[model samples]
Target: MVPSAIVTLAVLPLTPNGKLDRNALPAPELASTSGYAAPRGQTETILASIFADVLGLDRVGIHDDFFAIGGHSLLATQVVARAQQELNVQLALRALFEASTVAGLAARLNSSTEIKVSPLLPASRQQPLPLSHGQERLWFVEQLGLSNGGYNVSAAVRLTGKLDVDALSAALSEVVRRHESLRTRFAGRGDSAVQLIDPPWPVVLSPEAVATEDAARQRLVALMQQPFDLAQDRLLRVALLQLSPDMHVLALSIHHIVSDGWSMGVLVGEIETLYAAFCAGRPSPLPELPIQYADYAVWQRRWLEETALQRQLEYWTVQLAGAPGSIELATDRPRPAVPSFRGAVHRLTVDQACTA
Candidate 1:
């Protein structure tokens, strides 16, 4: 993969043995609100406010680049949802990505027809909640008894200084308390399945001692490869691997059904924020989320009923008309009925002239 951005450091972090402490290298700072341009109109003002709220910024300028200011596809979805709720304007997720700035997004909203969007609210706990459409596809694959480790979304970071383990544990617990998806479990309802939310509970940051860095890497990989029981176990996990007194690796793993790449980024940001606050013996600075994952799931099921469902089916029908049902690819062996979800690496060498 190509490098996204390079950060210049005065000096690289070195280990006790004077070797480069690769893990201690700081993450690149790609987002900056260097230039500020205030919003000029009501639509732009509202759009800017939504962006600021979703990104956890004090304020957002009309000309600010959303992606440059720590926005992603998942956050863009939130911005669109909030815009629909506030302005009664239907915004496509793709449209938000294309025209990410407040001024550009306001222009799109001004030209587009207004539509009604059902407000997402907490669903009743008396009844089981249905899975979101995206979650349903993952659940179906899980039902096939295939490899589940492929669905793990994981991240690792190295903490170089003395870490307050208790504060870290408290932060993880607070995060699980804040995000309902982490406390969720799936269960079968006749032929289909539903999600069940459990009350907030304590979380453990299991510690492991590794003799060498290689051993620590292996342990972290094993932790990530561990599968979850969708019907019983919690979907999120965290572990701390200690290589030395001041060097440790923090590992986190969550099921893809409850998280994705973009969501993982959001989770990391929130975790760091909470950890810093807890380390200082301060209360959580985060505000209560307007809606939880269960609310979104419930809203999705309701929105996809009747007209929306038929409209989607008809649109795809016309688009896929006369298309091949499947494509034939030459393989070393026939594909298995149930996917193994295994992958391998194949390396190739190309001439410079051919590349050119």
Candidate 2:
């Protein structure tokens, strides 16, 4: 069933003051205590309770899909972590995709099953690492009591001709090895602070080809539909698409923790140069980046301490003065006490007539 049928909800973006307009939420629905073959009432009640507690939602129904109401990848990881701690159930990171609804997930839990966890990098590479500038920023925002929004930065490059998949993959691997940000991690510094460190890059490649235009479009849709994982690994991901025998596209999605808009340009430029060099059988000519994202994080901490943060705070305060109390967006139903980041996404395109 579609998510709307279960719990219709949308998250209203927070205003500068960082408060939600509770009145904008839709009313909660009552739990369906009958009809299904499963232990509907018990399962629903248990799952709803978990959802309410974990997501900070007021009420949750059994039929509601965790993600449909605006669940995010990182949040999904938290949910899994909580489940392991509270329910003593080990859940695969991918389980949320299949068991989106509370009832569905509870049923899966009821059914004894095993999920294989992916192996980590080599022992030599397994060490505490540092956080990226973006990660530091996220941590800083959270420390300031801001809602954890899914901060992401990415780039899309249009390919001119047919792409050599094997060559591109090799080039990507080389790029990963060269860039420390793509290979970095966050380590805890006493209290709530974190330090950034360089770690071995572990890259996973998934490639596919589309024979027709419709197929290519479908592939793109599916790619976007797939949620990014922010819990197990760094948030950076890449997808290379074979649109046709003569055209292709490269899409990169990275959590805001590692990079920003300027950083994206830097990454794309480096990748293009490296790919071209690899294709021509020449060494990559790109100059070394003086500092990786981690260095920037360290620098940011130092910089913010130099009275600059006060000025920034003053600027923002005045800029947002007298602004609306909250940025309210309509939702289909009442929000849960504990909010889940899961949500459905729809794509729209314009044709010649529609555009013109």
Candidate 3:
């Protein structure tokens, strides 16, 4: 009459940055274990799939917390939209804020379900896909002025421990394959420039073998300094420097037009998941994304052109009317003749009490 199985639970631990620390949790005591647990019922199974698909996860356990594994506000909208479509039940977005797990969501489902939404400007799926409203604003600025070395975003991270180079390469390639915007480039100029989606190729991780850590650091600095030619290659590039067998630095660079601050996190998270899975000789832990950057672009143009232009313009016009065009930063040299996006970054740490 007594249960034989044992279940031990512990409080969740937080990383220095305040996110969940999966590694800090106890290792599964079982012989072998999967991070995901099986779903309990049909509704849980359906909800699991919705969560996995929306979050780019391979699987979801019934009790797994969504935000613990990188879910955010924008992706929450997706989960609500998808659950409405696939489950034939209307669930408020707040249901996620409240429950945030599969079982909780399934229990709270109520209200009449609306049919799936028609494509947001589905007709634009044809050739020469238009850029998103955000992209267009950047593109216009590029066209009018600032012809060179503008709007490039780059970052670097250090990797420790012996790495599997092949696995790392494969993981980077898969991330590029998964995100369409990474392989996309503008093919023409002026009003004619249209997005050209290139077929997936090896997102080259240009490797350099260095004699010492200092040498590797110098090469990394140079690689980050090198400017990108928008027409020459894909919008993203990566480099790996092997300072020694156990230490390396990864340099990842992307153009701002195709990528943004948010997309950066998505890229890094997917790569981490894929790399771990690859090193284990398993298949990628990422799901095929349901919608891509191209779809969002087409949708953005449609909404701005049809539904949002007047409202947005009115709001911004009154908000910024007669505002100063520029604020002068103390510069070391005189400014250039034409407007330029050429820039440098300065980071100053403020005291915690002052910041608060």
Candidate 4:
């Protein structure tokens, strides 16, 4: 198998002259991607090549999905632009969902199929209610940070057993109904922001499944590689992995807009509770959240504008002073004159003696 290359860049603070002052940035190491490879010769290949050119993917394949490869919503727009230029087809901003795979998307294009428009919530579900104070606050904070692109953050977990699809479905539904953030969407009000309420509950499960471990890994990898709708309010994704007859893993991802690490913990605890209850043949109702993510956004804006934030910024400036231009590393490709955060990961294990 051909080895894939990985890239990393140190982000620096800008000086008054507008040049990157690399000396002020932290030295982040380049991550590795030895086992991971992009799919080749599929519709994904065309898209991936475009993405690689724009985002600088060291290695990409046709079967590779965008999100699994660390593609975000900001990058999704870029992909759409490339598609328009290369394919000469008009794609809606949301086309990534129906035509996620290269083969899947290429088929759509070949057949001249129309892209379907999806609603914030499916019509079968109940309409969502208004946003709470907490949800409002979360939105404000995201806007302030200029990190309002992606709607969900996700992770993968391994599990053990033959998954009962019926039970898993019920548990997912319960989690969605219990959390308001899962159902909330943001509307732009002229120059301001508005939080539109909708019932966004219950996880949507894909019908596709693989029968073997290798096939399961390939499916999961492909799913992760594809980009999802992040500009929308609900940005959570979950995948179940059946590694063996008795071993399974769960991949949980949520958009940062509706959740933080703290909120994720809350979601996990609730999911566990609901899942256990379902397994026992009696599931209880989930208590309402004190507030939604939007409320936190509003609160964050107010907090950041206060004297406390001024002091915090001052501390950060001092703490990050005189760092370095960039972290030096051996790479598969020549370094770009300007650094970027094209990163990959490596796993390490230590022996007992090393631990000691």
TM-score of each: 0.68, 0.47, 0.58, 0.44
Off by over 4 Å in 1: 1-85, 89-115, 340-356
Error of 1 at 268 (Å): 1.7
Can you write out model 2's per-residue Cα lDDT over 1-356, one digit (the tens) per residue?
33433455566746568887666666545343342232266545666666666666666666666775556677778777766655645577788778877878887877765332222222222433445445656756544433434455656676877576666776677777777667554444664444444455645555557677687666655554444343345556788777666777787776566667887887777777877888888887876555554554444554555535676688899999999999878999988766576779999888999878
Best by TM-score: 1
Summarize candidate 4's per-residue lDDT along 277-312 as a digit string, tens digits.
888888565766665555554545444564246766
What is every candidate's alpha-carbon RMSD to the true fold?
A: 12.4, 25.3, 12.7, 26.8
TM-score for predicted model 4 compared with the true structure: 0.44
Cα displacement (angstroms), candidate 3, residue 186, comes to 0.9
Worst 10 residues of 2 by lDDT: 116-125
- Better candidate number, 2 or 4, judged by TM-score: 2
RMSD of 1: 12.4
TM-score of 2: 0.47
Task: Rank all candidate structures by their lDDT, best first, as comma-separated numbers.
Answer: 1, 3, 2, 4
Clash numbers, per candidate: 0, 27, 0, 57
Q: Candidate 4 clash total?
A: 57
lDDT (0-100) at residue 353 of candidate 4? 100
Total colliding residue pairs, candidate 2: 27
